[model samples]
Target: MANNDDKSQSKNKPFFEVQKVENEDGLGDIFFGVDDETTKFPDYVVDFKDEIEYFISVIQLLYGDTKSESLYKKYYERLFTIADLAFNSPQEKVKLAERSLHKLKSELTTSVGQRIRTKLLMDYLKLAIWPSIIAIIIVLLGDSVLTCVLAFLGKGTENIYISSLGLISIAAMAGGWISTATETRNLAFVDIVSVINNQRGILVRLIFINLFSIFAAILMIAGFLKINIGGLDSLQIVDSPTVALAFGFALGFLDKVFVDRVEAKLSKTEAK
Candidate 1:
């Protein structure tokens, strides 16, 4: 009876209680290249047993085995380099490598939907910022500008005031469009077609920025001249409507020309 009891107890001894549990899912043989009758280590993946063991320990500390395994597979081309750095490098460096992997994953080939959303959001910003604001302001201040212009520029200042607002929008929008074109020169030639198709959104933002910036500049100049800008009672902005708009338009066009001349002059001076 005792012999039978002893045999039963031996059979009941759990495999886990006898030894440290191994990864029996075949990853040990495949990833680490363990040698046995049932498995063979490939020449490429073989590392020292101690090195493999230590690497697994360190990585497991950072992430679960499943995550680490997935990352190893995904970044297989850079697997050893990443693993080596993570094991040997300082904590900060290791963290950086991990973050780089995540960034690559996140930004990897943006979807069509993502591109459209990004482009649209940028366009909406353009419309909201200066273009829309200036448009509304120009419409509201039409009568005031007419009154100011008629007093100064003589007959039919209202016509001139209306014209000035239109000019501001055109100049601002054109400048912004050109700037956007320059910005996209680096995109692949093939990609530029798609960019062009979606450019309506981007064009809107630039228009707004240019429009508002020029308007603000006009306001500042007007403030200097002590012009009464409609609804803008502050010390800054238009002394007279037509003059302010004309000055801003000239500046919007001439600024780039002036900058180029200055650069050329400086280059000649430096060459001498």
Candidate 2:
């Protein structure tokens, strides 16, 4: 009877030892290590030790930086619990522990990524809001605002070409703003992350739109591009200031398509 009890106890003994070491803050750390009898450990137990150590290191790195301390602490505790189970539990239960740890790691990583993306988006909005507002105002006011500035400087405000140029530039800015707004509204989480990562691209895109708008407007003014209304053949785009302003707005609104077409045409010309 005594020999049978000894054999049963030896068979039920765990492969690893877990010790609790308290920090200065009194929150203890779980020391998960192999037993002194190193040769008795199985191959899977060694792999679990390595993976759990890595998980602990990652948790420590993200603990203070994450927004919700309680949430992180919960995951930290769960990680150690899974490690303990992986080491101490029967061979059949080890796979369950591994799966749990993997799921927890995925959730923690996604949470951290989302928090980082949210911060980037907020910072971008703060920098972009004022410029967007100013652009919209300039677009709406167009030549009236330009005329006021020119009048204040005691310069002639009657030049049709000057007014047309101002109109084109401001209208282009408005078109770019509208395009950006629409794109932002439709963005998904991953798309937003990409946008936030490249915030400077938004400004660059607006600049391109303005440049293309101005270029197209110049072509119209120079008689290289013509618009003939179906019934009113007498009213050409270049002849009237009102028509010029509307045409500039259209060019600005369709800046991307216009630019692409221009590029394709240039590429074909080069091929020829």
Candidate 3:
């Protein structure tokens, strides 16, 4: 009867328990229960053991003896508890736990300095790529659209192919992309989190930059805005395709400056 009782108790035992074992090097290792054939854990659970151990070591390296050390210690403890549950869970339950662990790991790692910087570059790339593609499409179709518009207005379509508007608009887009990329690259890691959080705003800004550039190009073409290119012997942007494109690029590149000035003026008016 006693032998049967002992077997029942062993059968009901949890698969793993967390214990700290000190090695000869005086460093502690996380031991997940005993290594025996009776403990049949899935391969993913076993793999996660190594990952969690490594993560703990990284936390120690990053936050050790710092003001945030205690807070991170609490985080580690919480993760350890979840891992403990996962190790003892059934296969179906383990999968859910695995996803939770991965999410936690991602969130923690994203805040790391190097990771944040990489994310900043990636975010800027996403912001730049879409607008550039749209600009290219517009450029390719611009001549057809110009010809149609001129025909509708009873104007000559003969010089539509020579029009500088499309090229200038695309140049403006390129300038905006460069300007935004420069700003993103110069951001400190600490500020990157806020930038990442405001992805929608950044995307809108890119769109605005493209539209503003197009509008400025139109104004120049209509003689509402004039720019005299230096060393071009009094050649105005409207008269010279190459000069017009350059002017559009400058307008796009200085978009941030223009935006800031306008905002400053608005703020002053509001203060009064």
Candidate 4:
């Protein structure tokens, strides 16, 4: 019985020892050698509170020195944690997450208000990027596949098809950046007002983006019109204006699908 108890205790000792090592390693990674940078750890209990107060004071100072420093650091930390968890995360979201983290790290400092400003900027950037990237992928797919489908269906012009792809890329980027700006700044009349004084600016920019998208679409369509109208022999299919119209309508349908996704996100956010 005594020998059995000794063996059981020996087995438990290794397990507990391994757990303690793991916990220490985790703490060390989080602090990232900050323990070496600071002075000797205080001996007494009150020191922990004092250290926290000092850290807060440093953060406040940095925040004042930099633009949205505290917010930026917070955003950076949050996004960084997400990245760490999803290191093997799909390529689709990895770049976006990395960009946000990089922006915060590059723009922010640990000293004071700078971290806050950086955090805010990072979050704002994310709002613009996440949707825009998804939109870009959709636009790219719609342009490529839809164009090919239209051509097969006797409704596409090569010039128009190629131009649509380019136009969609530009439009998607614009929409993403603009939406991010509005979201990050929390726009006027929203629950969290991030852009308190830039209401007019936001509206003006949005108007310009919408007008620009229209112009780009027209330019692409016009380019298609310029393509040799005499190439009927090469394609061999009878070109019907109705077919062209139908193809245009199909593209519009894709746009509606994209809009629906945006609306759903908005609804979910509002509900939250």
TM per candidate comes to 0.30, 0.43, 0.45, 0.26
Per-residue lDDT of 37-143 in model 4, one digit per residue for the tens? 33433343233323223333333333333565555366434533534432323222333544554454433333323333345545535444554455456545755
**lDDT per residue as tens, model 1, 87-135:** 3333213444455544433332232334544564466456546655666
Each model's C-alpha lDDT? 0.45, 0.61, 0.62, 0.39
Model 2: colliding residue pairs: none
Better of 2 and 4 by lDDT: 2
Q: Summarize candidate 2's per-residue lDDT along 1-272 as a digit string, tens digits.
A: 99998777666667777665644544445676555754576677677677776665555554644364675578668877887676666432567787887787677656565564455455545654665566556545756877888899999887435555656666666665555555555444235335554564655665676678777767666655444434322124435656655665666667777777667766877899
Which portions of model 3 miss their true places by more than 4 Å?
1-114, 127-130, 152-163, 228-241, 259-272
**How accurate locally is residue 195 in candidate 2, as Cα lDDT from 0 to 100?**
52
Question: Positional deviation of 93 in candidate 2, in angstroms?
Answer: 14
- Each model's total of backbone clashes: 5, 0, 0, 28
State the lDDT of candidate 3 residue by residue for 1-272, as single tens digits. 99998887666555566665543533344567754746476587567776667666655554555576575666577667666666654322456666777776666655564554566556656767766666566657867887899999999887453245556666776676566566655454234445555454666666677677666666556654444546641135546767767866776788776556546755877899
Determine the C-alpha RMSD for candidate 2 after optimal superposition of all C-alphas.
10.1
Per-residue error (Å), model 3, residue 146: 3.0
Candidate 2 Cα errors over 4 Å, as ranges: 1-160, 223-237, 268-272
- Clash pairs for candidate 1: 123-201, 126-205, 131-208, 219-237, 227-239
Model 3's TM-score against the true structure: 0.45
Where model 4 places Cα greater than 4 Å from the true spot, the runs are 1-120, 161-194, 197-217, 220-272
What is candidate 3's CA lDDT for residue 129? Answer: 73
